[model samples]
Target: MTMPAFALDYLPLGAPDFSKIKETDYLPAFEKAIKQNREEVNKIVANKAKPTFENTVLAYEKSGVELDRVSNVFFALVSAHKTPVIAETEKKVMPMLTELQNEISFNKELFKKVKYVYDHQLKKLKGEDKRLTEELYKSFVRSGALLSDEKMERMKQINLRIADLQQEWGTLLPNATNNSVIWVNSKEELAGLSEADIAQCKKDAESRGGYTPYAIVIVNTTQQAILSSLDNRNLRRRVYEASRHRADGTRQFNTFPLVVEIAKLRAEMGELMGYNNYASYSLEKTMAKNSDNVYNFLKQLIAEYTPKAQAETKAIEDYAKKQMGTDFKLQPYDRFYYSAKMKQEMLNISDDEVKPYFNIDSVIVNGVFYAAHRVYGLNFVQRTDIPTYHPDMKVYEVHDKDGKLLALFYSDPYRRPTKRGGAWMSAFAKQSGLRQQLPIIYNVTNYAKAPEGQPTLITWDEVTTLFHEFGHALHGMLSNCKYNTLSGTAVARDFVEMPSQFNETFASIPEIFDHYAKHAVTGEPMPADLKEKMLKSISFQQAYALGENLAATCLDLAWHHLSSKEIPTANEAANFEVEALKKIGLYDEQVPPRYSTSYFNHVWGGGYAAGYYSYLWTDVLACNVAEAFQKFGVLKPETGNAFRQKVLSRGNTKDQMEMFTDFTGMKTPDSSGFLKYRGL
Candidate 1:
């Protein structure tokens, strides 16, 4: 029998041909690509000529092109339009990829050549070439290139197992989320929900293959957005429980075992690599430098924010008691609901009132793209000719200020049963000067779909999310790098988020806000007083919001801080999480961690193991960067070009902090700016 031909061979300007690709083609394609990549590596190893920078480091960088093409499309599909077949393909392909990685990382000959280039060729290489050589050498060392054979073999096993666990958790969690939807038997149970919300709930029930009156679909987070508006305490509790327990031991879809195994493997790997714990190993590559720095940073945040969060909780509790009488006690589900009411009471504003002004289309066109044009002088034209993975996805051709084509931007804007939860940006083809490649970047979001014939109106949070994810898109699309390895978003986890968070601040800019924030029905701009209240209301929940993030960050560190022997069993994970939160003094029954251990995908399934602190870490960097923009004027082209040249286009070619200092002309990043921005 012959394997089916795949469309991976030839891409139109490096853009994937998603239309011709089939699920069965994936495994064979990966097998072929891996073979080619191995042969490429072998050439470097076998060459009799003494290894030069071109023959070794540069050659290694250029190898795996075929593998990257297939893997990029395959993984992007698994993320954006998942099926059981894709999951199975992922399981098989991930281990193969892991084996390839281990082979290269552990290969003595390859490491020898790379080390030779690093040691003797410093004067010949310039700029990115020098940085790439240094980064590659460090990568080899960090990946156990210097380890003994026995330890290297153990490290390979750890890598393969970690890959398998990531695949399992990724597959299980989304299915668990779908199964955890709260089914309602009647309409009254959904009281306080708008007509659109009710209709969406009905549609959700229909999609679940039920004749039920309503269904409240669960997102990947512990807190449900719908909880803020739900008046029925019993129903709110049900929804909250569903979210909190989606991956907990309450169901067959439990990820507790995977979490434990993953942590244990990482701890052991860290020790084998000469670190105390996984956090130490992971932090060595990040801007934080070490675990102590991360701990101190998080500890300071907990101390400063805990009191403010407690005070805010008391204020909300007082207001809730006034409404429900002396017996009223606040639960986790009641926070969003009463806080929203409190916002209304204090500022005469609520999410529902502000949502009408945030039409999704306008937000993308005028708000997101408008800001892009202001900052980067990029233009977008819809590209219907290019085929997308899903019909909901929109393709646009991006052009630079001088009318040269820059990149392709894909946007998948609505939620479906097949798509995963959360919003993120990914690259199908990362920009590289060596390959003469232009980026094909896409942003995936999980906003609730508007009903047929109804416009998709979004909340302000969603509006900021649009700007945020596009911020990531810009990072990828605008990349001008010599090597794919040093391309956009390939920086340290702690530093990678700075660009996106900086972009998020643009959503509230008065000029940019005016361009997009208009009534969906009336096309009228938001009233002056209402707009002010809406913007002010954004900071109202800052304490609770930041505290939850800090707690989750602390929880991530706690899990990763363990030694191999100290890893908890699956049964002990819950108690472990409780104790972890208590240790950090962030344990609040009314305000749970944003993500519990079992469902903390960032550490277990995603790439953020021991790195979830990147959010808070980069939040400070983002606030400081935003402050720099204020000095030169936020929308000035000179300021924009300087940022683009210094930070955006440099990729990982320079030190992360040096890049910030380049733009800010500062000796160090300031946490005071972050505090002022957060109103702390």
Candidate 2:
């Protein structure tokens, strides 16, 4: 019998040949790739020559190309444009991949070769070679390479269990999100929504074959984006309840048991790793070295934000009473509604007024790509020749200043039942100097799709998100590292977000904003008065935003900081979350934590775990760097080149803080810049 030539085996230079891919191809491709990778590993362990950095470490670095190729494309599709076949494929393939990882992590002969290079040949290496050798050694040790055989086997089982649960939760989470959509019986209940929005909801209902005149789909957050404009209190309550209780209801998708089990397993693993708790073990590799530091940081934020949040809540309540009845009590659903009203009353600005100027296409070509060209001298040309995973996905060819090919970028934007919630950047291929590969990166977002023949106008917040995810893409595209493992966005979790957040500063710049913020139909730039009002509205609800974010971080810490004995059962999870919020003095009836535990995918299903604090932690660094860019000249090539050299292109070859100081001439990360920006 002859085997078929797999799409994973052959591809064009820059992009994955998506047209050649089929769901049935994954399992066989994975099997063949794993075998090839294992054979490659065997060569390293069985080499007759002395274990030099070239013979051992570098060989190991480039060994798993085929496996990496399959996993990258598979996972990217599973998140961005999934189907039932893809979901089922993920459920089957994840365990095989996990087992393979365990085999390599526990390969004692391989560990000996890697350690020999570190112990003997490290000083003889130079630059990224030296850094790669050290990172390889540390990676092995950290993956239980030094554990006794008995403990190693146990660790392997634990890792496999973790992988299984993660795969299961990945499927359940999105289903739960879709299942939680609130169906309305009449159009009168959707009074505050625009006609386009109401029509979209009706279309959603027709597609889902559910009750009624409209369907309000819940995004993967505690508060729905539409909650702000929803005039009916009961309907708002329904949407809020559905979002907050996602994956926690009596349906088959409830994640309560999975949450408890995941936390318990993480606790046990931490104990085995000789750490105090999972948080300690997770934080060991982050800039914040311990749970205590995270706690202290959150406490300071609470002290600063609590009073301001109280004042904001009082003002909102007063406005709510005037709008509703005097006896009406402000609820969680009312927060955004009343806050938007308050912002409008105070500044005469609203999302509706600013959205028309932020058509998605203009924001991308004129706004996002324009800013990139100004700062970095990078160019993005659309490519229709390449195939994409979905019809909606757009591919671009990115070129460096001297017209050198940098990367192939794919953009998949819009929401559907099959696609997951939120926006993110991912790579189908990563850059590597040894193999001489350029990056193949993609950005995925869940912006609501407009009706056919209608423009996809976006809010100001979505405009910032466009810039933010592209910031991450820049990190991947600009990376100039030698080894694949240490390339592009591979820095410490706390440090990885800095580049992306810093790029968000461009969203509000006068030149950048004027370039992109044009009316969808008329192509006119936003009016000066509206632009001024929009910019001033940045700090309108700063305290609540910061407080809720801090609360979520604290909640993540509280769950992971517990000992094995303290891992709560499923029933205690909700109460545990409330108590945790209260303990941090961040509990507010109107402002719930940004994500409650049951649906907090960042900590549970996503890789964040105890690292959710990275957003704020990196914000400190982002502000410092952004301030430097402002002083030096935001659009100057010199400033951009300095940042690329000192930070973005360096990967993890240097300490993150040292890289920041080198770029900005700052002695330490200053939160004052972030505080001033937020008006906190």
Candidate 3:
């Protein structure tokens, strides 16, 4: 297969044959791009001109365009469309890529050029250019440019193992999702589920040869959708056990051993870098600043949430007994179902009541896209010209009010057997001044596919999810940066979730709710009563929601905090997690960590790793940001524009804290905003 001049595999890679390449084009392109990078590096080293900002640092930044353009496609496919071929290709390429990174990090000539420009350019530059230079120099030092050759070799091996294990970690989950679900035959077994759920299950079972009478698929989250329903405690226990243990006890995909090795290796690498643990090493460049800050920040939230979560669980137990007429203890599997039932009885609302208003098209056009237009004066016109990863993916050309092209947005909105679970955003092309390239961004979600001929009715959670992801799209789309490494949504992990999570607020805002929350059949807006109940009910589930998240964060911290001199085995980490939770009064077998280490792709798959607590970290940032909006007003153009210019547009070209300060005039967001939001 020949590649297109700028193949659909990735955004146009320049105007030439770089744009049009086939899978067959990969090895050649990889060779060509790496060779081209080498030549570019050589030119920078050999240039007769003095190492000025323009000649040394800027030129070096621009030099890797070919290499970057090709790898984006290569890696995205490996993550999103993995198959035997892609998997094998990934294994083959991993060592080569890892070595390439090491080579550049250690290159003496390149460092000299970079150092010369940085030392001399600080006084000559302003804003991002100054920040970029500082960042690059700091990066070089941190990446071990000054290390002895032997230590560098050790560092290389540790990093190489990380890359491979991370890949293995990410690869195991999709099939685990496939293998973990149960099949059922009796309608009585489906007692707690809605008619729609039952219909969906029967349809699902029918598709699987009706060979079995009913099928219930367990999604990749700790809380199975079936847990909130399905009357039988036995069934709930079975599903819960399977989900909690999906990656444990199974040698085929078990990540227990991998976790221990990765943690130990990360600690060893960090010790090599003169840091105590991986957390300190990783957070050095991030807004969190140090492991102490991360610990204190999360500990504060835990202190507030622990009491409230306990109360909420107790409340649920009381409700379960009252409603079910049994002393059946409240379990993790029952939390969603009874809480859902209790929500309806107490607040007169359930997800079902809110589902109609957020059918797929309404949510996209009136909710997610509508808010974008209102805030950014952007418009989305769907186009079929773009190639997509899957058929459901919708592409659009976004333009400013002045009709200039702003960015390209693509959304993949349905779940699939092949797709690794969870919602996230990825860049096909990053916006950068060096390359003059606009961001081509994709929002991938795992919402249930709409039944045949049924509009994609979605719950409020799903609606917020769409908004959450598009927040990331806008961050990428709006970025104005000079370096690809510092481009949109490429900031520290703790800060990356700020924008996307911020957007979730809009999904519930009256301005947005009025526009998108409409019944598909009647095309009528959600009734004020129901919408009010929705606002009153689900959002208050904060205790339940935030608890699950906090438990997961605890689980992550426990895994990564292993001492570098000696690391715990997988079983030890698991035991350590239980103890961590117990110390915080969170040791509930019913409520496991949202993901067991054995199958947590977020930490292992991409860049998240021990950084999963970032969601909590940024929730604090975002919650405080919302306070900024409240003080001004949600619709203030001046404040929104300030946020855009300071945070979203600037990317990581500047230090992350500077971006926050520029917008909020604060050195940091306080922890109070998060606790207050959680109603703790």
TM-score of each: 0.98, 0.98, 0.94
- Write model 2 residue lDDT over 295-337, tens digit each, in one string: 7776776777778889888988999899888998988888999
Question: Which number leads on lDDT?
Answer: 1
| Model 2 whole-model lDDT (C-alpha atoms) | 0.86
lDDT over C-alpha atoms for residue 421 of model 1: 83
Error of 3 at 167 (Å): 1.8
Off by over 4 Å in 2: 1-11
lDDT of 3: 0.76
Local error of candidate 3 at residue 515 (angstroms): 0.4
lDDT of 1 by residue, 605-658 (tens): 788999999999999999888989999889999888888888888889999999
Which residue pairs in model 2 clash with each other? none
- Where is model 1 more than 4 Å wrong at Cα? 1-11
- lDDT of each candidate versus the true structure: 0.88, 0.86, 0.76
TM-score of 1: 0.98
